[model samples]
Target: MSESVIGQVATTATSQARADVIDGFLGTTRRYTTSSAEGLKQAWDECDLIISHLALGATTRLIAGLLVNKKTDPGVVVVDEAGRFVVPLVGGHVGGANELARKVAEGLGATAVLTTATDALGLPGLDTLGWDTSGDLAGVTRAVIDQRPVALVREHPWPLPALPSNVTEPGVERVERRGTHVKVLPPPADPQARILLSDSTAVPDDLPTVVLHPKSLVIGMGCNRGTSVAALRELLDATLGVHGLAKSSIGVLTSVDAKADEEGLIELAAELGVDFVTYPAAELAEYQVPNPSAHAEDAVGTSSVSEASVLAHGAGLIVEKTKTPEATIAIGRTEPRGRLAIVGLGPGAADLLTPRARKVLSESAVVIGYRPYVAQIRSILRPGTEIVSTGMGTEDMRTALAIEKAREGRNVAIVCG
Candidate 1:
């Protein structure tokens, strides 16, 4: 469970001590004192997870609802006073509630009951949609080995358990994270319910009892086959540098399906706790550039690296395509704030100022461009506003001037030729 969710649980326990349903709320804070703001923030995040774990009070319930909306990964599960039943009100798997349920049950001398189908029917499961912080790895491993069903946490109000009870499972369901497609298929629940995931999406699939919620960014990738871990690290550094993106911004890294089991790729995914996707060769080849990577060309199932890169971009998994190995290390997408609009005005009419253009001009802190262009919007300018203009300026000149003002934290509106 998330620290926030845990704190809510703790708060609930504290407030509901008289209810006797919750054991006394217990926790330790990193804070030496809550009187300080930083200390308070630590206390706040920690208490969130603790309270979420216990689900002990009203405040816990409230916070659980909020975190669900926010998509905090350490999942939430609320249970009855006896701990016999578990209801994953928020993040079910990624949040650690599925695993936490077992721990909580043991702590309470009860069963950490899991309600997801794979668990009920005894099949391999993985919490594909979870916080993926170090803690989730162990639980996911257990589900894989134990043949227990996994519940992916994506949306807040989890759908009811899917597939009718006592249905048959599709033949041979496997729980492998490093697969080409991590999608879920409702292959008719047999006496053994079979739920397999391939093709992961940002939102959860229409499976009963689970949903997927992913972060917003994608990490584009390419690497040498025997790329040493050191090499991978350097790649990550370079990629992050170019994009100006934080590791936290990336949601997943995708490549040709054959690369799924690549040692370095797997290690990288494990290290980052993010998904590593491998797509079909044909699918990957679709985006192949005029030429392709040496390795990608001969890749099994005939996929192209360029396709993978392009697909990642289109899927919004990656903000942009990466061709060079260094591109993998890009910091992130450019968060550019300034923009220029080139208009060919027949009359340069003041009455025709577009709503959007007018809005930009209106909000500009500094309007720097050609003196004539600046003069055209003179009527719209606020009195005493700074409209720095270089007389007799060309479009390029105006663009450069506008960029200068923008770099200095001034909003510049450039109307070019």
Candidate 2:
């Protein structure tokens, strides 16, 4: 899913010539070319994006029956007969039609006719943040666009783009009891419309909120030699449920190296779709956990296995060791490390951009560079990427800004021409 499959539909000789030029800019070795209606259907089934050198009306008519949804459908971009104007026909924001159209226009020296409201206004679309998001998308986006107040509730500090001023953290209030004032607590903001950043599976009741979950939790486990996977699963599920933590937030399952060959831990990690890692006993013994055991020291040369392994990886213990007859489990929260990529865009041409540079650009949440250089790679950026473009002679300032953005846990790309 990281790389996109591009299909070129060109029945006429002139269209085929245009397709060849676009293909060179795509930087893909495999070419899927089709010339008939049947071929177009096949392309739709296999391709992630379709470049049709056909009339806008004709392309629409052909793809009308194949449309599934913006989430599932391939982006469709139509290039005119003369290759003068490129237009995004469908899935403009969600399926990457807008970005693909920009790339195609750059290669052909044509204008990209973009009409998406958020793109036109230089605002981040809600659907394009590369997170699992749902609920009140259009409503929240409209609130942002209109400069209306939109409250942001976050369970953890995530590396995100610079949002507009309209989206702000909510205020708190003090509630009073029958006769005395109680503790001060922050009431939920805009129950009818707000954004919630939480990895917990529990959804707020009767609230029109958009939820975005961040991967932050790590699970540390220590099990007996032949613990059953079913027993371990039951204990893990109970731990998460009792603590109101989401299993989706579990990023890694770790233990001491003594359990490296344990079948139960390996199988459970695989079933949960997370990485399984182990730390050596000598390494795990460095961290002083609250609940250290002499029995564990005699068994594995480490005073603590479940808690020490988590702290060894720079995570804070959110949950202490909870154990069953044969297994022990602990949960910790880890901060995400930020990344900074200084990419060189050779020759300022679409075809000249290297695959590695293009990948960094697309994965970055923020792109900082000179105005011209930023514009050159703008088409390759995913939706919701914040661009910080300055004039020439500001290289030092741009580099500093990029570093600061990365420090905030964002993937930042500083593009140079």
Candidate 3:
């Protein structure tokens, strides 16, 4: 959860109680001030989201002066004095105001006032999918909402919610048969509207075409004990550039356990902002690779370090081992990790629902629950999210189905009342 601030018009007793309720559910830092204008302006500069107990008109007026574009602005949600309605005033999708509004409503037993067309029409927002997206997002999202012909182009078959009939998956055969190795797919021919899902950096840069990068790449490395960080970084940059890979797609940096404390490997992983993983020498030796070094086995007790470590972590090699004077680099594409979250809908009232539970429901790609329970939290779920509901006495069936969906790399949530 990100940091947030709560702004109030005054330090009155009523406002103090309301701020306490907001903080209890939000579970973040909270502040109360008699000065609404100063508090809001300072929150605009310091926080990711703001819950304003002031009047909607007043909050809007104050926000109008501090507004940057949607991408940079913080999410603002206005709670009425009575706490009857939670309204997302600005930055609905980009700043996460709509989702915040839903969570707040659940805590306050209020209604979330959503005005975004995509939410109203039950269509997924392009920017809200949690992927690195580029180009004409607004146009492509509108096409999805209007049921226009939008081509879905993918280099790999990523698990996503069911799209509208108007959105067609182009080159289905190619996408279905795509090999483990990463390759750039050609753009749709004369596409009027397009949404691309791929790990590769190369994609068409035309208007109304949005590119979504999947976190699919893992870099396996091996380095000498005293190797310089500069040398390792240079090799990494050159290798990614030559292969046309996106840095955003790289998810992990891995090596043999012998290099776990190696300064160069640790520093490089920190610079790349990816997790560093190390496998035991015996584990690394178990994996077969194209290049196995007898010298490495004599020195580090493993026949291979760079390529084998990636294979040990259940990834297929996309780029073979490339070496420099002090470091060796190899890249692989790993299957997406499956996630399963078991959530309980607290008591019966919406206000009883926990914030963490609400957040899991919002982020899930698939939600499974009883038919009645599913309906309870349906309003908070993102558009286009898949739902599987069953009758009573179907516990085994629901659990089995949730596991199957998760095994396919889908974020799944099971709800229990």
Candidate 4:
């Protein structure tokens, strides 16, 4: 199980001791003596889970107006001063408060008060179905809990577990034609409200849709050594827009290995919130491409950087190379690798590290950091693990290396002090 950074708040010393007991059990816990609004605010921002040794109402009031979304908010658990009941006061499902409450209750021998309907009825909510999914989560979940019929449409052959009886496919018995529907396909012509699951850049602008981008697009480029990020951004936006693609669908930005340290490409990828990867020119030259350039081959030892790099990663080119004054860009769609965990290990002390941090480190094929930080976790790494470390003043180099490894479908952990 992944451990959590728990924040404990209490008013009195006795309450603090009780909270400390729960903290010790959870590990990675910090105690806050001040129950003031400011302290609660700081905890809300810093911790993954917050346990307040106060009444439910008081806890709710302290965190008032700070709630963002189910995806980003911290799980809030409230325990009565007497420690009789552990209640998940907010972020019960998506933020993992319900699970945290159960763990706390089990540790303290208290009752866990859960009120989420899916948990109560022992059925998985439609919203709980993982992936980069977006839609009428509340509407579909409500329909499922009330046993109303729902339509599920999928374009790709993604393996979904057995859904509840209330949720059915397009052609099932007693299927509701006019009720809420979930679609896991490309944008349809109809402009009706529905949940959309797609990684394609093209989506129906006319529909009341919830778009789920699966991070399937890869952008390949070759640019002048000092090309400005603005120029790259303009070209990228135009290219993607011309192809009717969504920016969020992009998974990574790629280029020739020589451009690995190209500041413009790196900055653009960072601004787009995607990984940047580079392949050697000799490696890229091996891939057959539609537009082989003699000039490119003479310059970079590859006939084509934009097209060959895309195909080198086992992706089919969607848009052929489009050129700007000093840059060439191409787009490709590939099978999704999907997820990455970027963890921060504060202070480098064993006691200070969270269980989740350790779990991530043990599971990673590549452990990267400053040399001293890598040495701190040297004993716990699995056999045959790849350790990539750089000396001081090389933080960006190590980070880029870690991202490159992850882009190649390896779990990577970067430890920091």
Candidate 5:
């Protein structure tokens, strides 16, 4: 390993040892003293990172030492003497140990090994390791925490050999393998790890890690004071689908003024198998689009319908409109993507103006509405906001443009005359 190719081996070896290892591995690297422990300790403290040769005795012991003993937080890793295995000894997730392991394995011509369920089970990575005393992690119907063979229902990466039935459970559809160590998703080409399972539902309770399916989130919403649930749901759906998401991802529902108690929204959520959540009109009001219409006596607040979306994003829940034949079921925020806010700028000019609507327009990235409507905020367009001006046209064209902009994950303003 020439110093240049190996990038000058860094370590804390009385300066002499550091030079020795650099020269040894570089020029004529040699170990005159039989001090593996001393060298390793120095390597541990000297260089910022230490590389382990694959499941070899030294690497295994190093992993055990780091995890069981919690020595210095070195980036311990195992690679074959031939540069195979390349397993991250510690800090596999945030620290990039998992990624390093792959590189080492690749350097040694070994297969990359991953143990996460999403990778092992062959699903897109969306696992989590969290405590939900409220039991509201992510619409979890059935989740086994940090499972070994991950008693899971969904299938992820196909194992080298087919997974054992015991590896996963029947009812355990959602599986999350939790721990201090984070799991990495291998590229599609190389997924060759085994799935492990345990008879006990409880893992040893290490630092927790969780894995889960990438289901779209759903939120059932309820409103009041002449609010129509159907229009709300439609708005949410149209808005959500525009963003290339689905209805099934909803983990929970949200409504205005603690509308969680509202019967129509509640029933609708139950029908969809999602939880109903009602937030304060004030809270949901944060998402409300500014209503220029407020200046008018008839104008209410900014299109709070649009403001509701802020709740979904802030709540970590996607907003879905509940089913309702009466009220406008304008649900569309509950996409795998973020929520959609649709502002119905009230009838005309400065007469109906509200601070809330102004705030939304100010924050919107893509304002979708008639030329005049978007033109109303001549001075407000931020440099980043992409205003999509629908030409003077019919409701169909205007509606279409608003939906398109919202789906594109842009804050949309529907200036209906």
Candidate 6:
């Protein structure tokens, strides 16, 4: 669900005005104001964040026993009657309460009381390091804040942000393994206060470890004609289970060009919420794979459909070809690619353009547009922005170039008038 912000107000002129101001700042579609405590509780259950224009004591008493863990609870920010201070009452980092308090304080011209140590010390919390993570966040964060030694182990050299000085990889410096540590293994046999970055579904039973699922796996498939979707899905699920791989990590489903029209393969990819890609048979034949079948070579002009198709993208093979009666599947891991945002710069006017459109333009590595449209937002473009332009008559060429740039793993923006 999309994150929603709500303003909880009491029956007072000042509270109502403050709520209205907050609603205006956050946008009306997903922001609301409620007068009753019952309404606030309902909003709390439905929304991801709540800004209460009430006394901190009253707000605490209202949500007293219902407060849950930092990971699951909604972010709660309490604003005083005078709007002098914005205090995050619960779910500071993981639930984004601390960040929300800062934003709310900025909008209100008030002070934000942030009690989290990492935020004060300019260090990032371990839980907030990756896309999807869950584990003993509180323990590890506390350990890091207290300047204790922690271990970092990674299965793959996935690109990550620079960790704090206290967190180090094993064998870097001889430090006692006495405090909370972080590990990026699949599933450690003995668990401690550790953080794990893995796409494996198998979790440790005893240790308090955070598991982060990076979108690293790609599945390549080749199926016989007229195969049923149910059979293919079952085989794919079993294969992932046997390898301790998470379905969430599958970035794309790939195959040879011969199976592009296969409905079963397409449906499987759609159900898994990943893109389906096809390579030419000749292209797939260029890669050397462990298993080469003579029958597959005669049938599709590629000796190894699944492995070769995955390796054709320069990905590392993690799983060999496993087959069913009508299907064959392989898995590979690859680094994530950049996304493309096709935006329209409206009316060639800065005032007419939306803030989101401007932000996309600034974030884009390559901006493609007609010459006149590119000139409109030229001042706002960031440094190193590659501008690709065409004349007014060549809209098709602009679109094709934008698509090619995106396919090459660049964040592109196609601006239209």
What TM-score would each prediction reach against the true structure? 0.31, 0.64, 0.74, 0.62, 0.27, 0.57
What residue runs in model 6 are displaced by over 4 Å at the alpha carbon? 1-13, 23-25, 29-34, 65-70, 134-136, 171-196, 200-211, 220-237, 246-314, 323-328, 336-417
TM-score, structure 1 vs. true: 0.31
- Compose the digit string of candidate 2's lDDT tens values, residues 1-417: 147888888888888878878878887523445555765787789888888877999889888999888888998889999999999999887788888998889778999999888877766666776566656677777777777666777666576654654565565232322212244445534434577777677666465567776668889999889998899899999999999888867788999999999999999999887888999999999998989989889999998999998898778999999988798999999976678888999988967898678767766777888888888877767554767777867788778878887886678988887
Better candidate number, 1 or 4, judged by TM-score: 4
Per-prediction CA RMSD (Å): 25.8, 9.1, 7.1, 15.0, 22.2, 12.5
Which stretch of 10 consecutive residues in model 1 shows the poorest summed lDDT? 155-164
Candidate 3 displacement at residue 34 in angstroms: 5.9
Order of models, best TM-score first: 3, 2, 4, 6, 1, 5
Off by over 4 Å in 5: 1-50, 53-55, 68-75, 88-98, 107-110, 113-334, 338-417
Which pairs of residues clash in candidate 2, taking residues 3 or more apart in a chain or in different chains? Answer: none
lDDT of each model, Cα atoms only? 0.46, 0.79, 0.79, 0.73, 0.42, 0.73
Candidate 6, residues 1-417, lDDT tens digits: the string is: 134554454557787787777767766523334544775687678777777777899888888776877678888888899998999998787778887888778778899998888766655555554356656666766765665655565554443433555555554332221112323333222323455667787656454555667778889889899998898899999999998898877778999999999999999988977788999999998898998888788888999889998898667898999998798999999964556677887677875788688657755667777777888887777543657766767788777877776765557888876
Better of 2 and 4 by lDDT: 2
Q: Write the per-residue lDDT of candidate 1 for residues 1-417, one digit (tens) a residue.
A: 124334323223432442233333224322212222333244345543332324336426445333534235345545564456555544455455555555455445555567765455433233433322222344444443454454433212111112212222234232212112234445432221123221222222343222222244455455556766567767666656665444543566666666677788778777777777766777766664434555556645543453355354454223344445422321122222334334332357776766566656655545655566766876775432445556662556556756765553345566643
Candidate of highest TM-score = 3
TM-score winner between candidates 4 and 5: 4
Q: Which of 4 and 6 is ahead in TM-score?
A: 4
The TM-score of candidate 6 is 0.57
Separately for all candidates shown, the number of backbone clashes (residues 3 or more apart, or on different chains) is 69, 0, 0, 2, 86, 1
